[model samples]
Target: MTDDYIYHVDGDLVPASEATVSVDDRGFRYGDAAFETLRAYGGTILAWDAHLERLERTCEALSLEHGLSAADLRGRIDETLAANDLADAYVRLSITRGVQPGKLTPQPDVEPTVVIYVKPLPRGGLEGDPVWDGPATVETVATRRVPDASIPAAAKTHNYLNGILARVELAADSDEALLCDLEGRIAEGATSNLCFVRDDVIHTPTTDGPVLPGITRDIVLELAREAGMPVREGRYEPADVLEADEAFLTNRTWELRPIATLDGRAIGGGPVTDRLAGLYDDRVENLCYE
Candidate 1:
């Protein structure tokens, strides 16, 4: 997040400190933007197709004009990696609804604001370190996820006030904030997808509700299925998660993290978390880029 790093603004590489957007930008005035977070493994972006496809769908749904092709964006990311000498890095791609001064609604043909950059991953991450060897603690927040009726939950838009408010309720030592739907059903973590293990089966809330269909979450589900583990996707209540044998969170950053406790209740370690972690590592190591 330093100003020394190189960044891309509308396909042109520039210094991070120099990257700026107009105040009139809708994305700045209002959270009218969509973004995607990706990571490079040995200079390759994993699940490129899935991430790009989701990004495209979000842009289309939000009526944001993204004129660049996936291949073009891929090439640009590669260039950024090379320019910054980053083999393994955290990449954030954001596209705003663009500048429409004194207007709440964006112009029909306005060009979108594009910002892409790479940042150093956390310690023990992407450096062949064991980031999720042990369990972590999480807390339930009072804030509920914005219902799908208001805005598509699957879209990675910049309207993160809900998640931010949830984070405020988390304790200083908590790893994440587990948010529930308005009906008091478990939805997802603040920024990560939630998954639980019960009866040797992996259970996650269906994306039909207010949960982001995370790329990493899908990959984890597929890994579970291919490993012959039973998988279940449906609407789950908080009791279902609290009573589960084990639980974990998934995102582009940590990949997979085991939840040790929720709301002061201890969820013990299990073989399923270990198995899925191993499979995740194997997949990352053997990932092929197009």
Candidate 2:
């Protein structure tokens, strides 16, 4: 986050302190932007294809065509990493609907504002330390997920006020906010995906609902399935998680973090979480570190 690092803004590399966007930019005024948070290990961006696919889907949902190809974005990210001398890093790529008429309705013609920035993170692999300090303590909040009907949940846009409100309700010591849908079904954390183990089966809220269909969540599900673990995705109540044998959160930054307690109940993670974490590490090691 320091000004010392270089940032890529609108196709040009600029010093972070000097990078600026117009006040009339639609992304700033209306949160009309889509973005992705990615992890890099040994100079390789993990799950590049999956992340790109998700970004494209989000852009489609917004109906804002940012005229930049995958290779163009990739080159920018590569230059960012190289410029910052970061082998292992946290990368954020954002594309905004450019300055438009100061009206709610977006214009048909679009000039996009694209930016890529990265910050160093600890090494991540078989022999690496977790980016998170310890198991997370979570609190179920009153803020319900915005229903998919209201807003397409698939878009990873800058309109994060919902998540922000959810976080504001979290306990002072809590690491995440678990949001339920209007129907009282578990949705996801403020920024991470939820997964629990019960009767040796993994359960997660279906993306068909308000869940973000996170790239990390999809990878974990596939890894569990390929490892012969039973996995189910559907609507699950908060009680289901309360009674789960093991629970964990997944995101690009955290990778995986066990839940130490939920709603003040100590339903800590166990062997199942350990196994899945190991599998995820194996994946990272094979793909990026090996």
Candidate 3:
């Protein structure tokens, strides 16, 4: 379907181009908003309930009104996908603090703006490309991920200039960039969560670490557990990642992608990574189309 298809704003389906908010909207001027990205496959949204819960959590963190219930939001997403005539697509759910007067304080009387947009999934390379047979090279950027004490990096908020800058550096030097905290401990990739398999155990940075709690990350962890693999969430140093048996990045768009190298060091797909990928594919197929 074309981009001109209707999107759901608040509770109504409206033209995509017409879905606009005021310049004084808190989300626009002050980055006061929360969002969630989900994948739609075969007319079903993957892990919808989880995504919505995270969104609600983000709103709660920001003290913004959600303006809708989880069930209502899911219904709107379903309707938006149908209106766009896309069974396989990407869903963006955004909740802004709404329009307020010229000040930093939020207007309690104003209702939050809730918008849902459907976009076609990215091309072959950005997602799980068939060429993704090995570990991807990762470079550590100069920019550090925001610590949770300052902004709670786990919240999926609109404040992402730090991530954007790191991604730019990665694009110029490496396939991906590994972020660290102010203290220089490994956090995660710019846009995706980091998962590495070492000695048959899967390790990822904890939510307490400076990284977003990615939905794909959770899914991978669940799949790993179901496969009877041990999963650990804790602090990981760059050296630990470089010496891992296998490594991959996970997110909504890309799902799971193998990383072949980090800073020119050689890393490739191992048995554990391959098994995890296979299990992920099976789970998605069953959950989305069953």
Q: Cα-based RMSD of the predictions, in order?
A: 2.4, 1.2, 3.0
How far in Å is the alpha carbon of 75 misplaced in model 1? 1.9
Which parts of model 3 are misplaced by more than 4 Å? Answer: 122-135, 171-173
For TM-score, candidate 1 versus 2, the one ahead is 2
lDDT of 2 by residue, 1-290 (tens): 45478999998889888889999998899999999999999999999999999999999999988889999999999999998888999999999999999999999899999989888999988988999888999999999999999989989999999999999998789999999999999999999999999999999999989999988899999999999999999999999999999999999999889999999988778888999889999999999988
Best model per lDDT: 2
Better-scoring candidate (TM-score), 2 or 3: 2
What are the clashing pairs of model 1? none
| Winner of 2 and 3 under lDDT | 2
Stretches of candidate 2 off by over 4 Å are 1-3
Of 1 and 2, the candidate ahead on lDDT is: 2
| Model 3 residue-pair collision total | 5
| Cα lDDT computed for each candidate against the true fold | 0.85, 0.93, 0.82
Candidate 3's residue-wise lDDT over 1-290, tens digit each? 55597889878999988887788888899999999988887777888889878888888888887567777778888899889888878888888988888798777775788889988753231233343344467887899998788997768998888888888887564677889998888898888899888888899988887789899899889988887899999998889988998888998877788888887777766888888777777777777766
Cα shift from native, residue 197, model 3 (Å): 1.9
Ranking by TM-score: 2, 1, 3
Better of 1 and 3 by lDDT: 1
- Indicate which candidate wins on TM-score: 2
Please report the TM-score between candidate 3 and the true structure: 0.91
